[model samples]
Target: MNKLVTFIGNGNMALSIAKGLKNNYDIEVVGRNIEKLNKFEEELGVKVQKHLMDNFDISNKTIIFCVKPANVECVSERLEGKARVVFSVLAGTTIKKLRDNLNPEGVVRCMPNLAASVGESMTTLTGDEEYKKEAQELLGAIGPTRWLASEKELDIATALAGSGPAYLALIAEALADGAVKQGLKRDDAMAIMRGLFGGFGKLIQEIHPALLKDGVMSPGGTTAAGYGALEDGNVRSACIDAINKAYKKAVELS
Candidate 1:
């Protein structure tokens, strides 16, 4: 029999993961609003057991924690029952914190981005060793899963994979804008930009970044000229700094 997966928050992340697991699990949603729970059920394309967060029993049920990091205390205050396990998608929130606040048998810190909505998230997990395999299989239902050794490593992964979609989206938009500036039609530019990213995504998996860069440029070619401009603009350093800053923020949030 498939296990039940209850979501503590009826928000986007909850909806996303629910979408990925709807076919496999009996889903339940708990939130502050009945209307939102109804909406969540509709969005997830399935009927769900709904309860106001203030009154619910989680004992022996798997929970996917999607509440905002700051709101955790409030949510925990309302959870009257213990959970069998919790896979928290809250960035920077640690397992110890979850255990203390939520009273779960096991706590897994999970970092999954917006792509989880499409079953393509690059999720990272870490927590109680006994639940490592279970965590991977549960999260892998939505995307690829990486089991990191410690909370520190999971925080760093959150800075990378958890926050990666927004960074990539910015680059995609900028590339399309550059094409539009060079006189391409806006629609065409967007289409080509999406195609470029699509193809590059596949290629990137099999090729090293340095090798890919070298393969795209010849000494005095257009690729080399553009590459030089990116270098001059310090884009590489900026990207490195971005990861560092995001990682630092995750640590602070924890």
Candidate 2:
């Protein structure tokens, strides 16, 4: 590609996006320190042009804006030159804030999970009307993307898809722990848990969660018994609360 995509940070989020787009674009990274930038390159296994924030030039460069929401203002003060376009992955940060602070020609607010590192993220994006399609296609290089009509909608998606992987990982680990507590070998329990999640990942795409659960939970069986236990333990309520709390946090951050 002729255009260089300059990532504005060297953290996990930046690394993940860079990993997905490395083959398709010319990559350059900007960070505060040379050692961290070199570490990023080593981890990414792609030698990219690097620049310090004080010396980096943003004019006309496409930016993968990956700084934390809390640090956005401080980072914005350090940046100079007009960015051609910026695709930001800061959850709870708005396009208006980005424009007022970073002063990009166009800003696309996005929420992409860590799964981007493995090319399986569910990225949600919303931005300037003209850049909507371009943003989708660019993020689609890593995984499928959904373009939302409004920032509020994108905020809800962030609470769900952006925070989803961590929730799922907790369940996976807990499931393995359950097996280990029930006398299964730790290694075997972990292996089985991973396999179960992998298979369920494929199955869920085809069947609704409720329908799939109903199909497995025959009357008076092991599945039913376990389901009953989960119900009694208020698992569903806890999950609902998780989403509510996360969504509230997103709103508060905004």
Candidate 3:
């Protein structure tokens, strides 16, 4: 029999994670709205046990908390018993907040992107040292997981892996637009852009980015001209600043 995993919300992130874990675990979702919970099951394409949030007992259960960070305290008050463990996906929420509010034996802060739905999330985790192995095994089921040494490191990773998808999406759209501006048909440009990203995803796993770029840019070639244009546009500095701003915002949220 598969192990049980309880999700505390039926929102998008919860559904994404459940999509990845449904085959490996029995799912139970607790939420306030019955219709939303039912919709969650339908969207997941799997039958899941459902419970109303009011006076719910979490005793002996593993919970994947997917509620908004602002609602953590309010929701915590409604849970009736201690959880065996809680792996929270709430961005910028700390383990201390989870432990103090949710009253779990083990608390973990997990940062998983939207890619979790596809089992390709680059998840980052940190929490009580004793729960490291368990956290890794549970989260690793969905994607590659990195266990960080400190919450600070996990927070930084949140800014990167957690927010990186949106950044990449902006770049993807811009590149496609650039192609269209150069007289390439919109449909063809989009197809080529998608193919470029798909191949780059695989190649990036095997080579350093610097090495890959150096290999591509021959003297005064198209790649060189494009690379120079990107530099002239201050894209690199903007990217660096984006990370710093994002990281600081994560800290502020915490």
Candidate 4:
């Protein structure tokens, strides 16, 4: 029999993680609303045990804490007992805060983006070394994972991997829009952009991004023209600044 994993919230992040883990583990979701819990199960298309958040005992159960950062205190106060281990996906919430508040035997901070719904999240984790193997096994069900040495490094990674989907979404949207502006049908543009991104995803894994770009660009070709335009717009600088800003925001939230 598969081990049971419990989720402490039923929000988007919770649902996404549950989606990826459904095949590997039995799921139990605790939430404040019955309707939301039911909806979560329905959307997940799998049966799951559901419980109200009030006075829920977490003892001996592995927990995926998915509450809002601001509600950490209120939610922790409601949980009745110590969890065996807690893997938190709350952005900017510190392991010390989780340990102090929830009194879990082990605390791990995880940063997984929306891709978790499709088992492709670039999850990053840091916390108690004791739970390293367990964390890898659980979160790895969703996608590739990188276990960092320090909370500081994890926070920076959070800014990159955790918040990366939104950045890529913006770029993807802009690319499709640019193609549409050049007279391609909107649907065709979107399809082509998605295909381009899909292929790039594989190529990037095998080669440096600069090498990938160079391989595509020839002297005064269309690719070079487009690449030069992107450079002229300072897209690289903007991306660097975005990472810096996001990292600072994560630190501020802690």
The candidate that achieves the highest lDDT relative to the unseen native structure: 4
lDDT, candidate 1, 51-119, per-residue tens: 998757788888899999999999888888888889899998888888989988889899998889889
Model 2 pairs whose backbones collide: none
**TM-score of each model, in listed order:** 0.98, 0.96, 0.98, 0.97
Check candidate 4 and list the clashing pairs: none
Write model 4 residue lDDT over 12-84, tens digit each, in one string: 9999888888987999999999999999999999999999999999998999999999999999988898889
Q: Give candidate 2's error at residue 104 in angstroms.
A: 1.1
Please report how far candidate 2 places residue 1 from its true position, in Å. Answer: 7.8
Tell me, what's the RMSD of every candidate?
1.1, 1.3, 1.2, 1.3
lDDT head-to-head 3 vs 4, winner? 4
Model 1 Cα shift for residue 152 (angstroms) = 1.0
Cα-based RMSD of candidate 3: 1.2
Q: How close is candidate 1 to the true structure, as a TM-score?
A: 0.98
Candidates' lDDT values, in order?
0.90, 0.90, 0.92, 0.93
**Model 1 weakest 10-residue run by lDDT:** 1-10
- Model 4, TM vs. native: 0.97
**Minimal lDDT window, size 10, model 4:** 1-10
Residue 80, model 3: lDDT of 92
Q: lDDT for model 4, on a 0 to 1 scale?
A: 0.93
lDDT digits (tens) for residues 160-198 of candidate 3: 899999999999999999999999999999999999999
